[model samples]
Target: MREITTVGVIGLGTMGAGIVEVFAKAGLSVVGVDGTPELAERGRGFLEASTGRAVAKGRLSEEDQAAVLGRVTWSHRLTDLAGADLVVEAVPERMEIKRDIFTTLDGIVREDAILASNTSSLSLTEIAAATAQPQRVIGMHFFNPAPVLALVEVITTLLTDDEVTGAVRELAVRLGKKPVVVGDRAGFVANALLITYLARAIRMYETGHVSREDIDAAGKVGIGLPMGPLTLADLIGLDVVKEVCDVLYAATHEPSAAPPALLQQLVTVGRLGRKTGQGFYAYEKPGSGVVTDAPEAVGRPGAASSVAVVGTGDLATDLVDRLTAAGTTVTAVDDPGADTASLAGTPVVVLVGGPEGSCEDCGSGDCLIAEGVDPSDATACECCHGTAPEAWFGAVAESLDSRTVLVPTDEPSAWALLGRIDPEVQVVPVAVHRPTRSGSLVEVARQIDGDDGAVRSVDATFAAAGFVTLVTRDRAGLVVDALLYPHLNDAVRMLDSGYAGAADIDTAMTAGCGYPQGPFAMIDEIGADEVADGLTDMQTETGDPALSPSPLLVEHAVANRSFLG
Candidate 1:
């Protein structure tokens, strides 16, 4: 492989300047080129401002900052790249503009010099087709704020030489980047999955399924993402997100890739997210991160004063403690065998365990018994005979008359148990796990109630029970798991398909998205079999191929071996 010493960066915009800084900081001489002297100077100013901030924050000494600045030379002429070992084009997302630049660079640069495009979602083949030396052209796609991010996608087209790919990958490693080699597909790996997820969030918002704040909260608290999809879109600039969505949709024709109507409308009105101080949420100012919300048009629903907590074990204990701490009147009944008379006047009831018995034996007499039934009446002991209490509708008929019931069960069981309840009873199925982050709340499947105010009341009840709430539709995996499991399954498929190794895929997601752990690591932590089962169930419900569990995942699950092990 040829060594890369001097790098030439064209179109010194935000991405271009960051790329130049990354190379310069790695001790490579960089020629930052732009369309004119003014743009070149502006790019230089951006570089100086970035370095100055670093110095002010004590991230870099003054001497080191000066050295980084000294290594970069700004110019307006493409001919200045004649001695460059590699030329990276970071121009706008226009095929004609990029083709023109690559064509000019082909004539100006040395015969062996590599040419790369820092495009997030454009076709490398089409860009290379404009040059005579197509075999030398590849993609070195970097994440935004390239100097701060570590992931570099090295895209290889059909005509791209193996040596050229290897050289670029090596150069990325030398510049403190984790490079993953991928095919020249639209959005590649990260953005392909990311765009689909973002589109789903927008659809959820547009359809009035959940509030914007709760949706964002779900992503942050449920999964360990650095930011929610909408907030990230705002930070990324909605205009750019729309463009990428358009490019992906045009390439794959996947409905999930199409930009939602709401996104387009926001862009049309010039409310381009944080860049323009408005998008999904209002920002303090243009390019600001601080967010503020106007007073909600509808007021919050009233809170419930009294709640009955039933079932046994740690989950029940936690719920009782939380409810007690929240200052709500809590009637704690650990014995499911207790008469329903104790739960008569409670306005809300939280069932902690699922339909199946919470104890070790199936015949454990822990089911909720009716008030007037004799304990020895075999006919009325359906719960002890492996039937859920909700199945015995007559048993809880009195309790359900005027009260709201909250069942915190697994996603698959939520619907089945909820379906058995009387239609007149207000029931909400919630998937509650131990909080992943501090102050994170449980996810409430709100479609069961079909009223925003009713859902809010349930949310308030949960709050009174000492839990935060994220309201979502009564979907198979709820919000967090629905978006999260499919992405993990996709990562597994990527490993199974030989696109990349487990370690590399893990590295890519963590470095690319600021996730606390990569997909494989999460799979191992969650148990391979559990992850596989969840994906299989989701796939069956949604019919999305992305949700299908990889065969490797199934095999590992069957063998009870960790992916990492």
Candidate 2:
């Protein structure tokens, strides 16, 4: 393949200008084009503002910034790109406009010159087929603010030549970007997984299974995302999100890719997210990230001076540590045989049960009896059947009064335990999820009877302990696990279909979409067997095929292997 020294970038919008800056920063001669002179000048302003910020931040010297700008030759004409070896069009996402540009550029650039598009959605194959030298056309999809983000999805159509893709891939490396080669698939790597996940989060909220606040909190605190999916949708513009979802759904016919009615309605109402100042959330104004209506709008939590924790393992141990560290007097019980007499006087009683945090065999901790198992044939896994959770819960409940708030940690059916106790002791659903860099989160399930004293006390207690708290409804998976596991399954399905390699998918999510960890890394960190089991259990509950574990995930989980390996 010929060397790519001079490059051409068409379209001078935010994305287009960023692409121009990327090439110019790499010391390549660039012909940055636009449809008109005004847009071209505005494009220059984009370059100036970006580099100016870098200089202001001391990350770039004024001389270097000037040199980077000096390498670009601005133009409004297609003829100027004739001398360029690679010309990437960052025009609007309209198919007709892109096809016209390619058809025009087909005669302008040389036969061997690579013609690439920076489309986030739209078919690269159709665009390539519009040109005379189809083999030389490819997709060079760069994430927004292209100069900053490290990922560049290098997409290849069946018509694209191997040399063309290779040259583009090498060029991406030289440009200081990580390129993940993929077939002509909608949303490609980063977006395919990302949009699907976002859509699911929206659906979850729309279904009222979880509130919007809880959904976002679940992603942020529960899964350690930088921002929640709804927050991201607002920033990305709901219109764009809907548009991409439409394309993905059309391409794959997957239900998860279908845009939720809430998302579509928001777009129709002109609440196109932060751009309009109203999407899933109301922003301070147009084009602002500051939310006007914050989720944690509630007043200070009701205080709990002393709490009693019952049961054993990591769940109870962690709770005890956090509560003690917060200065709340915690009466601890490590052994199963420990007395429950102390649980009677405390303001709250936190029940952290057996080997699985609750009952071992029972699903969702909803009942002492595992679903589908006969009462007579219950498993001997002491937690569910024998002298385990049933014993501790009965003991603790027998001692506690109506005044004491009981929180069954990670249990969905904490309310059901009301029968086990004599008094109407408010049972709150509390799930202490795994801790992240941000800190641990205690998920509180909203009580159906409007009993919030338990919620506030649990919130206050966990908050004082320096841990975040999110209140979701009493549903399966609470908020985090329900939304997260399915998205990982989607990534696995992508890998299973050979659309992209494991490393590339991970790279795309981590580098392109600003994820803390890739899906595969999450599966490994969360445990493959754990994720697969979560998906399987969720599938049985919701009957969503998308939530069902992929055969690959099951294979890996059964073998105790990581997807990265």
Candidate 3:
């Protein structure tokens, strides 16, 4: 309960040393212990080097570095932590190893001192049971690069006392990290959802559905992730990923977390990632883990002179922006009033929204239109939208005699469109490599131009990931608004079902799911009507009573008149 002036960090590995550095910089004296004095000294050296790097980067002053390094006292003996007010065990994630350390700490540290684990995959309850005071044991999972990555998961087990949980949350905030308290679930929240997603991605690759680069491209470009899961796995070390997967699978009994065959093989071969020389793709840069390929490009001389982007949704807007960015002339039009002037002197490509239907130029594969350069080879409804537009696009592309490239935004849509497209039509989904601040294709194009890179290659990456298509697909729900609405409605449903209070549900999801905002707050941010429309779409698609739009959602959507409202 007292202010933690002295802290003990057991085990001084990569994560351990980082933890020590974080605490020391926070002005807390640290007793960092390792198995041997040599290991302990190495830990101290890592701390010094990390702090020195900060000083070199102007993040920390020279004096501040010295002060921070001076705060940590490396020790080989467990008994050295006797004077500490708090102890965080960052030992290798093994039950016996952690149990052994906790057993030792129970005898050495003061009875009142709180004990925590930096174990990401291990059970907090089991670890706490090793100590006499199980109430003090909690999971304080700091992300990799402890001092830099902002989110800290504070896991509270059934046995973890509320006061201990509060203290850990306070400590995390004190260390300048965003803290979210969670229940002692397997992989907690982020890892549980993320690892499963990663496994599926790997499976998708292994099945030869998409290339490794394309998989990474889909995640980085399609979803706004800092790093693709493959790259992240490489950075974290493939061995560690495999181990984490094993632990999650063992704890949760879920097959999704079980490491896929390709993942295991890559780890086994030691092509771990940037750390190794190879992974999903050969890393041209050792420390940075950037990927490159020089395969012969395919599908040249396609007939796509000018395009008409139909629909006024976000997808259509993104398409207009992207097509313009790609140096292709584009015109946006509603069904009733088609602007023929915009299609002047260019072959028109119709981009339809929602499911495929009777196009204005149906049955006529080639609608001849007189222009400056002979009659144009007309392609009716170049693309379509919906949950699985890619299948439709794929089907359409396969049959086209003239070469044309059809782009789909996300996996479902792309796959749907892909099904309908001709096999010969070179399909390029958006797959961005670099980090993007904005999800919009227009912004990404600007970012590509602003940064020093081959514009053609960057454009290709966008095309590969389907960013060129501009329609973002929802994996769980049908559309963005629809996909998110049920979750928010579920939060409200939780309130109605007496599962938890509104604030508590929000708190849990924020801490538990890494949602930027809670469900109710999200409804306001995303607009109630938008959510309602999405739900209505989902309800129509699935015919599930549960998916029917909530009354509150209907009220809010109509009242606000916008999804964001």
Best by TM-score: 2
Candidate 3 accuracy as lDDT: 0.62
Q: Give the per-residue lDDT digits (tens) of candidate 1, residues 1-565.
A: 8999999999899899999999999999999999999999999999999999999999999999999999999999999999999999999888899999999887899999999999888999999999999999999998888999899999999999999999999999999999999888888777876777788778778878777777777777777678888998998889888999999999878677899999999999999999899999898999888887744545345667777776656776777787788788887766545676656546677665543433222223234443455433322333344444333332343456545654544432232243344566666667775576546568877675465555677778776665667778787777777767767776777688776788877877788777778889988887787778778877788787766788988988889887777
**Model 3: lDDT of residue 89:** 91
Model with the higher lDDT, candidate 1 or 3: 1
Candidate 1 residue spans exceeding 4 A from truth: 292-301, 336-340, 354-408, 411-425, 447-454, 464-466, 489-498, 520-565
Local distance difference test, each candidate: 0.78, 0.83, 0.62
Best by lDDT: 2
Structural similarity to truth (TM-score) of each candidate? 0.84, 0.91, 0.68
Off by over 4 Å in 2: 295-297, 354-394, 411-420, 447-450
- Candidate 3 per-residue lDDT, tens place, 47-96, comes to 98898888899999998888998888999999899999899999888889
Candidate 2, backbone clash total: 0
Which window of ten consecutive residues has the lowest lDDT sum in model 2?
A: 375-384
Per-candidate Cα RMSD to the true structure, in Å, reads: 4.8, 3.3, 9.9
